[model samples]
Target: MTSLAPSGHLTIGEHQLEYRMIGPSPAEGPTLVLLHEGLGCVGLWGDFPDRLAAATGADVFVYSRAGYGGSSPVQLPRPVDYMHREALDVLPRVLDAIGFRRGLLIGHSDGASIAAIYAGGVPDHRVRGVSLIAPHFIVEDTSVQSIAEIKTAYETTELRTKLAKWHKDVDNAFYGWNDAWLDPAFRAWDISDHLAYIRVPMQIVQGADDQYGTLKQIEIAEAECYCPVEALVIPGAGHSPHREAAEATLRAVAEFADRILNGHGEAAHGQAA
Candidate 1:
């Protein structure tokens, strides 16, 4: 993978976000915008961005949201609409700040749901496709249970210590997501209606053993989305398929990007079962 240093500080409103751009420029092809998971930051992505750039030959852009990594700090107890705000408002500004020409959104977990919302809410022609990994369309008991367990681990185990190394304000980052999900009002949160508005091709990657969500998320995409949808269910993998099954995840994403973004004709409208 080609080495490219992160370009620091893109101010999206009152906050400054840390971001990195790798591989070719927008002039070369559509950029791949990576949205990290609930507890994730740009640094937490490890070498995946580099490997993805190597695999897809498209520019890879990654950033740490407020309070994560080296990005500007945000207050604790974030609003329930945090994900929706990020997708509907902040993400578009980030893209514009970077001068994104055309792109694909590759999002994981919480990030994936944000991408789904963005694609559906925004009528941006630049978004050519979306690749979701372990995305949640609606709140579930399993998801709530898993998040509650993680909160316990954060307080009791070495999880906080480990995460502290990645986030500037670990509590802000942790509680922002935790409190919102655990809030009773968040139970009504769902993005399934947004799927019907998504017109770009989509690829869904999920771990069969994902503790946070189920195939119901993918089923919603297949059922509601008018765009072509492809699904990849990896066995023996859990929540983070890109981490647990790197090669397979990378190949699937790269191939999808090639077919949808670099192909000669419009993507076919069908479901890949």
Candidate 2:
């Protein structure tokens, strides 16, 4: 895959966030800000964000959170409140710096969790919609099992080394991600209460074979959210649908963005099964 163009950086609060701007020259085509997964950085997205922006004629803003990729490294260990910081503090500042008055949120894995919180915190006018790929609500046996498998691979194979090349400070990125999920307080974590507060349209894309999140996580969000929601479970896909099934992921996001921009008034998408 071709590399994304050099990304721009903004000094949001104490840290400088590394963000890439791709697609049409203007920010007019309904911006879709991509939130990366755990252990993911702007480089980790490969070509999918560019593909999605190209497919939908939308400007996409893909960024690496603090301590990941080219962003400012984390000086201290990530606190339990880190996710809260991203949602409540960092995201708003990013939007303001980019002059993002309104846009859709496309988040995968941990990014999805952060999007839910950020969207929930803001009023409807600030957000157009949200689309989630392989999202999680709370940690599950399945989730833990998957993490264990990843740990095994990291310990016994070259996965750790491979990932380290992309991250300047891989230990900070890896431990910050792994430890946060494994933390005891994270187990009781549930975003359902915040879901009700999001008035914008929402879509969730999960893989039937996703090792991290069970179907119940998506189901609960669909059932509880006050606004219109659509869920799609792609067969044979796994935890990272954007990588495992990039074409379909881009298509779904394009359709969702189209619906929102065209003034569909209500959410509409093919159902999940």
Candidate 3:
């Protein structure tokens, strides 16, 4: 699959987000937005989104948030509202600036949660659907422990050095995400309350062995969400199902998007058949 060379920059309020667009031209097909994991940027997503867009025939848009990639970097000691800032304020701006009204969202880790928040807030039925990989509403102790382990490994092993190549400000991005997540204040961060408002068709893809979240997260979202939800638990896969089982995850998302776009899938649960 060919890598994407996306034009960057979409302004939101006073801030500009750096973005890339891939796949078939946005004019020819449905657009699918790709949201990266906590420590990810356009570079880290590599060629997966390109392959996915090819398979689905959807134009793909990807970006780095403030302080992550080429976008304007935030000074250190940023507030916890940072994630909220991206989800509530930044995402819409990017979509609107690019003139994509209806599109599929493919998000991983923190990005998945952001997609959920976006889907819930927009009242318009203009959104075609969303696909979540390793999403979370409430942070779990298991996640914390796993994160602790990662931090330890980063210090003791080569993980930090390896990750440094992918991030422009690697420590800034890593600690900015890590410290806030491990903070006690973050445990209370739950978006399950907003699930009922999301009416777009969605697919939740989780790894059975995901170290960051439990299956309860998926169960809660599916139960609370008004939209038709499909859950896929890939056995033996960990946090990054798309990375670990790209073919399977891509197939599931492709079929799900096809169903929704073709009007063959149920929209909200119990509203119709």
Q: Estimate each model's TM-score.
A: 0.93, 0.91, 0.89
lDDT of each: 0.88, 0.79, 0.78
What is the per-residue lDDT of model 1 for residues 1-273, given as tens digits with 9 covering 90 to 100?
223345678878999899888854554567899999999999999999899988777899999988788898888788898999999999999888777888799999999999999999999999999999999999989999999999999999999999999998899889988999999999999999999999998999998899999888888889999988888888878899999988888878888887876784333323222
Q: Which clashing pairs does model 2 show?
A: none
Per-residue lDDT of model 2, residues 1-273, tens digit only = 122344777787777778788854323446788999989999999988788777766778889999998888886656766776898888887777776755788899989988988888766475789998887766798897788678778778998899888888887888788777777777787777888888887889988889898898887887779988888888778999888877777677778877786654344455432
Per residue, candidate 3 scores C-alpha lDDT tens digits across 188-234 of 88888878988887788888899999999888987898887888888
Provide the clash count, candidate 2: 0
Number of the predicted model whose TM-score against the real structure is largest: 1
Reference-based TM-score, model 3: 0.89
TM-score: the better of candidates 1 and 2: 1
**Candidate 1, residue 91: lDDT:** 95
The Cα error of candidate 2 at residue 97, in Å, is: 0.7
Listed per candidate, the RMSD to the true structure in angstroms reads 3.3, 3.7, 4.6
The per-residue C-alpha lDDT of model 3 at residue 88 equals 82
Q: Candidate 2 vs candidate 3: which has greater TM-score?
A: 2
Q: Which stretches of candidate 1 lie over 4 Å from their true place?
A: 1-5, 264-273
